[model samples]
Target: MSEGFGAKVPADVERPDRVLAGLTARQVAILAATAATVYGQWWVIGRVVPLIVFAVLAGPLVVAGIALAVGRRDGVAVFDLARAALAFRMRARRLHTRPPGTGPAAPGWARERAHYSRYPCGRTGQLRLPPHAITDTPHHPAPLACLDLGTSGVAVIAAASTVNFSMRTDTEQYALIGCFARLLHAQTGPVQILIRTHQIDLRPALAELADSLGRLPHPTLRAAATAHHRWLSELATDTTLLTHQVLLVLREPTHLHTTQPGFTGAVGSGRRVAAVTRLAQRLDDARRTLAGAEITLTPLSPEQAHAVLATCADPTRDPTHGWTHSWEHTP
Candidate 1:
């Protein structure tokens, strides 16, 4: 008996003792508690139930206990799992119901009829209304009316050319700064300056260059022109050129009285025209002020103003595709 016990087992041999193993200690306790609860219910009832009836009553509890105890190895205790499941179920139920006072105001009968029309199964139907249908409320503001010089009452936009600030001497830069200061100091209303930098598209420039190359008279020069055009084509693909635009926004005086009260009791067209004229004069003054500092300012046309707004609204869009000219300079 001692020799048989001491003998070593081969590595490939199966271990018969490990087969038919029972549940872990925690799983056994959970299953015992579930069984006791079920048995207690049956005893209280004082009846012998069918197997199917017993399974229907107690199957879920047994499955839940076993799953909580042994299904996962993520180190979460059984009670935490049960709490998480309860919370998840509560959230699902809340999401299925409509919040109070969100949908259209209607009588209970109308709402019930509409619901039955959409879902004929009454309360048992699984059809669900989209959240947007219940929650969406749209309110659109009135479109802005433009006055002379494309001026809106809130702001005036002016296109300005950029000077090489980095290359200017100290004295020149100081003069430029002084000029800007005076420009702002002259404004009785608010002033806002917006600077936009965008990638320049070179397709038109390339086309123009190609057209110029076709007109070269001398053979050697024509050959050289062809080579240069090829180089430009390659360069266009390899590099991106960028341009800057400056916008000068001047505010209109909101306190100015109208000649006649309009339907909205706001500023009348005559008053708006007068206000725009004043704003345009101020912009011209600014233009002259910047001109002394070697910067040029041009007023944007209605179409140009729309393009500028579109580019500003979405910076990633191609700035030059729609507009005939670049925003950085006048055509």
Candidate 2:
């Protein structure tokens, strides 16, 4: 007899090496169980008579199970993949086509409406909405009416730098907390503390370094400077450098009445001066208290205050830095 016809087939033919090459033994077992359950159910139902027909019906389930198992091995969950697919589809369908009657180059309002309608939550049309001037919200509070002692009340803005409480001993931390509480208690009116943390901009520092490097004479120094610049450029792209700003808002009570008997009429400059003087006194007291607690407090000028407010309201803009001008009156 010929060896191919009569001899037992090789073991490799019975259990092929390529059958489930990438899958672990456990994954292979699970897949086998899934296929068996699907086919066994079909057989019990007496609906699928042929193996080919059963495979046609059950192929999708097997493929899906295998895909899920492979994704799990690669540290990707099925839900995450589904969400990413959905997001991609949504993004892909976000474009808009102009209406038939509209010209090739539509008006600005029509373009905006078309853009808005592409999303489910978008408003209908620009014509139905209020004018931009009226609808636009102010990014920052309106410049204080009076610039100094507005109608609301006399207010002051000061930035303070605090010590690292976390690094201190428990006793020091408790003492600091107690002192801060006393400081708050000492305030006669409302006090608000606003803490702002922003990514530090390294452009100015890099520029300075570049200028210094240009001044150097040696080639070795220049090569080192180039390497340093490259490292700093990479570092600047990371969101690692952060700066914290603490703003203190103190509002002083307004005195509408003056001691003078004739003050019953319109308030005079003297009364305004007195109110301003009281505000100044309160600010001085606050500065002293904070200083005693080992905190450095610097008052913000009107321009600096405006910049700070704008920076906060819209984070896309850069804030004015190193403002040295002091407000002579009210800011």
Candidate 3:
């Protein structure tokens, strides 16, 4: 096929074209820059340096330049990988739960005694992390259902129900696809669909079943419930039962930066309310639009959102319904 004749969306849309010798412009630039620098160094000081010593130093540098230009690690260029590795090494090794400048200060004697902390960098200085870079609860997380993604704008998550498309006929599938396409076309802002699989802990379920066994109307029903509980108990002890959940994330860029031309209009405290209302309306519209496809979108409450985030952060831990992750000022 000719270059412009392709219909399918290319997988790597950001991929740069190879201009010379199967090397992209960026690769060629890296190689050229490395060669130029090496040659410049040789031209300036080559007379004083031993021939073998220059060869040894220049050989490794040239090899590294070639590697950086051509080699890839995990689909990332070696240059990028090295830069990331260096960045990782330079960053703080530990993180404190507390944000900078809060909580009671240590006593003078205690401060003197513990002048050097085990991971002083994590404690003494502020290392920028998530939730901190965004809204400041003074950097502590507040009970916000939606995250104010700062420059990227505000975002919210909704628990969405899925449709069993595989069971539908071709005609039904096409209809559903058309409905879905309409949903996509109607989008006023960016939207994301995330599917997460979680393992169910059947022990608690078995316990609940065990508790309900005696409440059964018939002895036969009670026996069957007891048997089912035993089976679940066995399964819990043996293997994991996984269930997939669909979540819808809606995002709208506030363009709230005062310097930006878009922000010439006022964007103060009232902006948050307007943004949230807009998000909710969008979610509702999504719910109504996807109704034809039998997909439901239920906006998660702040507590439920926390639980979902907590669960996603650490899947091994059980989700809490009643727990409130508070970050209110403690004066």
TM-score of each: 0.46, 0.45, 0.64
Report the number of clashing residue pairs per model.
Answer: 0, 0, 0
Clash pairs, model 3 backbone: none
Off by more than 4 A, model 2: 1-149, 214-226, 238-241, 253-273, 320-331
Model 3: lowest-lDDT 10 consecutive positions: 131-140
Model 1: which ten-residue window has the lowest total lDDT? 129-138
Q: What are the per-residue Cα lDDT tens digits for candidate 3 across 1-331? A: 1244324777778888989999999899999999998998799777889888888879988999999999987788898899988888777765444666665676998776666757444324344322211221222123335655545666678787878887887778777888898989999999998999887757667778888887889999988888888777888778877999898888877666643222123554356546756876787788898888888777665566656666776687777542222222111
lDDT of 1 by residue, 86-189 (tens): 87655433221233454457799976887778544323212232111001111212122222222224345677887777688777877877898789888977
lDDT of 2 at 293: 68
Q: In model 1, what are the clashing residue pairs, if there are any?
A: none
Better of 1 and 3 by TM-score: 3
Which ranges in model 1 have alpha carbons more than 4 Å from their true place?
1-154, 165-170, 253-267, 320-331
Q: Judging by TM-score, tell me the better candidate of 2 and 3.
A: 3
| Model 3 CA RMSD to the hidden true structure, in angstroms | 7.8
- How far residue 200's Cα lies from its native spot in candidate 3, in Å, is 5.1
Clashing pairs in 2: none
